[model samples]
Target: MTTLPDSFLSLPIAHRGYHDAGSGIIENTRAAFRAAIEAGYGIELDVQLSADGHAMVFHDYEMSRLTGETGPIRTRNRDALTRIILKNTDETIPALPEILSLIAGRVPLLIEAKDQDGAMGPDIGPLEQSVADALKDYAGPVAVMSFNPHSVIRLAALAPNVPRGLVTCHFPAEHWQLLNEKTRTRLRAIPDYMRAGASFISHRHDDLANPRISELRAAGASIICWTVRSFEAEIEARKLADNITFEGYRAAVGTG
Candidate 1:
């Protein structure tokens, strides 16, 4: 299994590229990524497959939330998506290559491939291939992960040399309504860590105390937590996490 780089564990990653919608720096847009790069923070962003099989840096499957446009992001081709400006910003939706070129290895990058199969089942591919293609020539401290184990498994095959991880959490039914009880139960245990060849996990901050997290860490998996919004939460998350993926507040370098 490929190990996650030190930079990923050391840097306080910017969730969704240090995005602050209040500041017009929309998540996964060029402005947000540039801001994160300027702040010297590692960037964590999400990608979805465009209709044409290109990887687009975006968090939601639907464009309505970020772009104020209608329909699923995959319903639009890359060119069309690129033409739609993000809400409250001049930046258009960026392709994976565009963001990769913009960052140019300046900071650690963490890419999460959103599950194309709403149920997080075996249906996955084109998006993983697109992401692999984008990173084929990228020289950087970068890693790929997903909440869906199948996606991580696919990434392992597609980008064998690139470090891979799982985005894990206790799948609370209310928050994970799309996933069935059996799926949630299986995922909560993170049974695919070995099968996916994952070197690390970015678990939900509140769920850091889960015994499985400690078990994985004891077995050599790096622990990372997501969406820490304040210094206090960062402090709490650090008890179990090797690093944090944060937004809304500046994470002091080297603070525990």
Candidate 2:
């Protein structure tokens, strides 16, 4: 039962490392991370496993969106993946270790392990283990989370000392077509909060008023929400969330 530190909750987090694609700072790349660190905001990024099992800091499972290449991210080894320059930038995809070394505890990090198991089921591993291995020796104010509870459960076993959380959201059927109705219904309620050994939850910002969120807060879980794009939205989210993960605009530091 590791606790989330105050630093993690004190400042607004930059969703995907303060990315601004128009400025050549792509999401989850070194440039974006550097921007976040320079801006004095906490960072929240996603990680996926490369073919050889190295942890890569990226959001998409496929390369087509972020890179010129076309294939699943796991199809490429770390070295090859690192060479595929991000679209519109000279920067290549960064490995977890590279970003960790760059940040070096300068600000709190909230890392989300992308669900390799497309159905958000139990077929998880290599990625969580790689993340654990990366963090084993690093000293930082950091936490790991995922939309998949099984991934968080795995993190508890692999890196028990680091704080763990769940990325929660309303499972709107149209948006979550891959998840069956039963699965969506079960997850929408967030029943795994206790079972996953989560210290906090980074829920969807617009869904903050969901009663389950209130229930979790009542049970003492630190409430955080994601993708707050405007200061007005931040003000609204803060009413229910202990902190916010934001992007697209500058979030005032130490003000919430």
Candidate 1: stretches off by over 4 Å: none
> TM-scores of the models, in the given order?
0.98, 0.98
- Give model 1's TM-score versus the native structure: 0.98
Model 2 scores what on Cα lDDT?
Answer: 0.93
How much lDDT does candidate 1 score? Answer: 0.93
lDDT of 1 by residue, 56-118 (tens): 999998888877799999999999989998878789988999899999999999999999989
lDDT of each model, Cα atoms only? 0.93, 0.93
Clashing pairs in 1: none
Model 2: lowest-lDDT 10 consecutive positions: 21-30
| Model 2 residue 113 distance off true place after TM-score fit, in angstroms | 0.2
